[model samples]
Target: MQGLMQDWPLTVDKILDHAKAWHGGREIVSRSVEGPIVRTTYAEIHERAKRVSNALLGLGILPGDRVATLAWNTGRHIEAWYGIMGMGAVCHTLNPRLFAEQLVYIINHADDRIIITDLTFVPVLASIRDQIPGVKHIIVLSDEAHLDGSLPGALAYETLVENASADISWGGFDENTAAGLCYTSGTTGNPKGVLYSHRSNFLHTLVTMGSDVLGIKATDTVLPVVPMFHANAWGLTFSAPAVGAKLVMPGPKLDGASVHELLETEGVTFSAAVPTVWQMLLTHLRTSKGTLSTLKRVVIGGSAVPEAIVRGFRDEYGVDVTHAWGMTETSPLGTQATPNYAISQMDAEQQLQFKLKQGRAPLGIELKLVDDDDKPLPHDGTTFGRLKVAGPFVVGEYFRAEGGKILDQDGFFDTGDVATLDEHGVMQITDRAKDVIKSGGEWISSIEIENIAAGHPKAELAAVIGVVHPKWDERPLLLVKLKTGEAATKDEFLQFLDGKIAKWWMPDDVVFVDEIPLGATGKIDKKLIRERMKDYVLPPAAGVASGAVALAAPPEPKIYAPEPEPEPVVEPGHEDDAWLHWTPDAAQSVDRSRREAPAAPADHVEAPADAQLPFRGR
Candidate 1:
């Protein structure tokens, strides 16, 4: 027998309704694509969103119909999201960064009826209008005056809300009804849709607001630099409103200058974005001598956070950097690297090491690792395996059952990532399952190598791909893109990795290029790298031929081989203990020493600025 409780459905509309009633005056600032900043409160947005619901219904949008939105993170876009989901319609967010053909394919796949888009995307939508026959009407997220003649027969967004009634009912349907659709970046194949339910979204928003997660509070001002189309901007759109935190949406212009301007002008306290975007911001801050006085925390994900970025934010700027890990399939928040009580007791360097790994799973999520045979692996932190997750927010299957059954019999979904979870509950991603290098029956993590190479002062970007080797079966090839005015030789990089990593794990060769390929989601496109380097040949080593087999058995299980020599023993209460510990200064010293003799120039090729590279996985 269960205790009696209210049977209130956990619909997405309740989040807005509660915010409107309790925090109606909270501010929502947006950088408009129409050359102005628009400001509105939760109460005002709530009323306008209701009108949007009525307007959509008038356009024959049924409860289960999918309404696509090709827009940025603006006040109007937020209103469109609530308006579409509130009326039980599915909100399908289209990424503008994707190719035109990809957009057409997604639109056709979703069979969207009404598309609400920003003014900037009007021309793009117009170009593909003829191909997407399912789109019945196009609504421009602008005033009637801003509607271009080229977008024939499009309705103005403001006119719809201004002419509609604000009095409308919401949430009469089941909580499990589909509320939104977000497609993966389609690195491996055609983009697949992850249909999110109202229940899942509501649960996800709740978890993100918890102290151990995004830790959003009403007193905070959030700037989600991550695009709204990317996994619901990592779920900030819903969490911000649910907690009544002020929002500052940076639309269209995601460059360093624009982001810095908003962060300072709007008094942003917390923000989230990928590493590349943060790199630009850090560069801007250093060049301009700007300070992040108000900014407190930053969530870096979509790709691994570089060690330099973490140090720059934490050591130099006094800002907290949270290394988050997730994908579109997990409502985009599977794990976050927020410090815990156990971590607080450690030294600063130890804490940084722990924080560098993806933090523990929050209360609502369950994580596990398994070997190739689907057997459960121990949470020993050293044995890397395929990462699997199950939670209220994780996807059970793709939209329209595209990939068939995705979850195992035990209900856990494979994350397509290989990782290890320590006894302290911290999880660290070693590599993507397909990207891991198998050399002599042992695995080498490409991500670990790339991170170390990217941490170098002269290396602007780095990617590691496995090449064919006759002896070892596969060997890693290091690709590097130097800074604008910086240079480094292959020997310099190899020497830099001497004590930091195992000798056996070193790259067989280094090839310098002008730029490394980045995927649509701003991740290294290894698939394209492999295709480009398919014909690459490795140079001969000391004794083994380039293709000769070196070993028959895999080494004992270890993430990285032990250091060549053990540290000297220190007496009790000795001063050398402090020096022996890994400190930021020591790390910088090592980096500086490596650059002292780097005058040798290496042969490098330059690719055209507008190279037409294929987009690959996230």
Candidate 2:
């Protein structure tokens, strides 16, 4: 017999509808683009979204039409997110951080018909507006005050909503229809769009709510330091309201002091951002000698969170940091490091190490470590392999690409991450497979080396990239970006790294730079680093063909060693089934629902908003 709960169609509108029906009173506060905390309830958001949806339909936006949003994280931006998706039109969030030419490419590539932007970004849009031919309407999310009768063909955000009715109908959308599009920051090449379906988005929010994961609740005032243009602000925009959590958006003020003031004043309970943002926040808090008490949990992803950061937040402020792993294709939330009971029993240092890992897959995700040949490896945590996953929330293909087959034979998305899974099923990403440095035929994790380097008292941030080495094939070159006014000599920094990591793993040399370049998504742009320093000389190979810089052949025919097959086990029922794909074991049943449960830890404490602490909840 089949279960009563058959497959029910899901859409972003339904997510908003539920918020309005049940948690309508919940607040969504934002530091408006114009400067001020603009607050509104979920009920208001639902109505406005409806109005916006009606307005889009009036604009002749058809199903699957791409409505672009070039705005910051604000109330109006959130409205545009739901408004476009609710109408069955795809909401393509354009990352303003990307270069102008790339922005033009994305807008034209996606064939954006209409664009909704903020007052601050008008100049940027104006500069590139003529380049994108398909854009028909440009709606500015502001009032007439900012309008100089300039910007031809641009409409005001209020004008459209004011004329449109809020009683529009929904329930016409199929869950498979595209709901949103987010491009990967093109550090290596042109940015590619990861088209997200309504079902994938809805399920991602559910997984986001897991107590040990993003764990958001109605009473919490959440802030996404990550930009809305980047992976839906890591899905916090939708996930926040899905659970009725008030979203506190930091508009243009993302500087240390500004973010600090907002977090303290707004009583933000939970926050999410990349490591770069946290490093700045931590530096500000330390310099200011501020105290954070009410802050309960923080989700740190995008790049690996340095061990120092994990230690600082937990030991100094008591804020639990959950490390997550995902990509634009995964609705941005995949594995989460929720320190299970076994790891929690370890000492503070050991626990911190565990917390530094990518953690286990959320409920809906199926994670596996695969060898170069696509054969699965063990969950022993020692075997490093490429990571692949599939779930309800993970994207299967790119937007409108021909023959767009993105998944493997059995349907798992290769995440391009090289990682290991512990016996507890926790996955720790050592580095990107492409970034792993092979020295003397053995792989060295640049991420590990960099994380250790970040622990140096003088180093503010560190990036390790594999540079050319004649003998070793590839050797690590450490690029150190010191904090403002901080100083550390090369000898001192090298000494600090000396007993912390393996001798073979130590960087051959250290180079200090004014600053590290950041890609569009705010992550370190390693590709640019390599390109910038490509001319550096390398030491001779030990035993390879010549002493000169000898490059290892790219993973080809004779590169990877095969794993021994598992002995055949006599099953109680049938042992006649021949083993198919060589995995450590049969694919663990993939469940698409784990991505939906709230994964925040229960220990999150909330205090009154007016508390004097730097990290208190309102």
Candidate 3:
């Protein structure tokens, strides 16, 4: 029998409503795209968001219409997000870092009716003006004074909000109505969109705000260096308001100095960003002799966290570096490295080992390890298998069914990741399913080798990929981007990994370069790296001794081929096996999207990292 309940739908608009009512005075700070720091209260932002909704309505936007935003993490951006979602319109966040072609593809695929963008993206939109045929109107997130008429017939965001009335009601539709749209980075293939419903996004916010996840409090000052366009700024956009926390939006300048200034000036107690951003912060602090006075915890993700970063924050600055693992799918909070009771009781060294692994998922999500044939694998901490996940927040299928039938027979979605699950429910990603190297008929983890090499003192960044070898099927090659003014020999780096990883997994060659490419999501971008290093030849005596000579080239290994046929379509006759059609009613019953990589060894447990950071005192 169904129990007696209030039947209150969990829509995202209520989050801002609750924030306005109970935490009206809470400040939402932002480094404006123009120049100064802008401040507004939750109540003010709430009213402004309503006005934005009315303005969107005046522009002919209706419920379920897609309103695109190509802006950064600012107060105005937040207003645009809420205004779109609260009015039952879909807020499709566009990644500014993506190429013109990619942006055009995404904007057209989404069929975005209107675009609310920052001034920085005006040129981008202008360049792609002829490409995105679906964009109806362009609204710049600026004021009248900032308008230069660079793009004629563009609307000013502030003027629109100021002129529009705030009398329209919000959120009358079903809770499962489409709320937001975020697309993957498409490192291997054309990007696919992840359509989020109000119910799933609301549920994700609650689960992310739990003590073991984000766990932010009202009194905390949260800074999101991760942009609003990136999987909902990793969900900080909603969580901050839901918990009444003060949000410090770091506009577009994510450089170390700018971020440090915000952390200090705003007294930010907690911040979340990718590893590269944190590394920059640490570098700026080291060079400038700056300190993090009020910063407490830093959540690092988007890629594996190097040991240097873990040590740089905790041992030097006394800030905890919380590693996280998720993709554009899973509402981007699949698993976090927050310590549980058993892990908390372990020694500091043991705890470090667990922390390095992508920690267990919280309630409302489930993880599984399976072999090649889709058979379940044991959580014995050593066996590598494909990672699959199932949950309300995980994507039931990609938007438009781009990748067709991602879920298996049991409805578990394959994450395209190879991982090992420990007995304590900890999971460590060994490599991307497409990245694990096959050498001498054995799988060599490029992630594990890259992680160890990156931990070297002089190394700034590192990437490992399989290369051609006559003796073995394929051999691992290490590419290093050393820190500024830092020099190292090949022997020094290879020796640094001595005894740390298996001998078979040792990189055959070390190539130094000035810079390593990072993707729009702040990942290493191995796909690009392989293309750049296509000419490098591995030394014949590689991994045997120092000063190995170059080997004769063999037929280039077939590994890392441009992601073959990633998009599989269903035949016209196979309607029964086709993905469920997306109707409003079908969408109400459906919730969840798909798709990351990580590093570390299985048999070995690492001790505490070196505490001697280049920075000053904690």
- Each model's lDDT: 0.79, 0.73, 0.78
How many clashes does the backbone of model 3 have?
Answer: 4
Residue pairs that clash (backbone atoms under 3 angstroms), model 3: 394-592, 395-592, 395-593, 396-592
Please say which candidate is ahead in lDDT: 2 or 3: 3
List TM-scores for all candidates, in order.
0.87, 0.85, 0.88
Please provide, for model 3 over 1-618, each residue's C-alpha lDDT reduced to its tens digit, 9 standing for 90 to 100.
998999888899999999999999999999888879999999999999999999999999999899999887899998899999999999998876566677888999989999998988787788788787778899999998887888777899999999999887888889999999988877767888989999999999999899898889999999988777778877888999999999999886777888899999999999988777788888889999999999998887777788888988889899988877887778777788888888899998889877777788889889999999988999999899999989998888888899998899888988888889988888888888888898987888887889788899888888899988888978998877676567667778878998999888878877665445555566666775665456667766654333211111111111111113233333344334212222221111111111011110000000010000100000
- How far off is model 2, as Cα RMSD? 15.9
List candidate 2 stretches off by more than 4 Å: 4-7, 402-404, 538-618
Residue 432 error, candidate 1, Å: 0.8
lDDT of 1 at 27: 95
- Lowest-scoring 10 consecutive residues by lDDT in candidate 2? 604-613
For residues 1-618, write the lDDT of model 1, one tens digit per residue: 997999999999999999999999999999898878889999999999999999999999999899999887898999999999999999999876566677888999999999999888787888889999999999999998897698999999999999999999999899999999988877667889999999999999999999999999999999988877888888899999999999999877676778899999999999988777788888889889998879999988877777888999898899999888888888888888877788888888898887777778887799989999999999898898999999999899999898899999899999898889988889898888999999999999898888888888888778898999999999988777676676566777777767877788999877665446565566776775675556667877732222211110111111111123233233344332211122211111111111221111111111000000000114
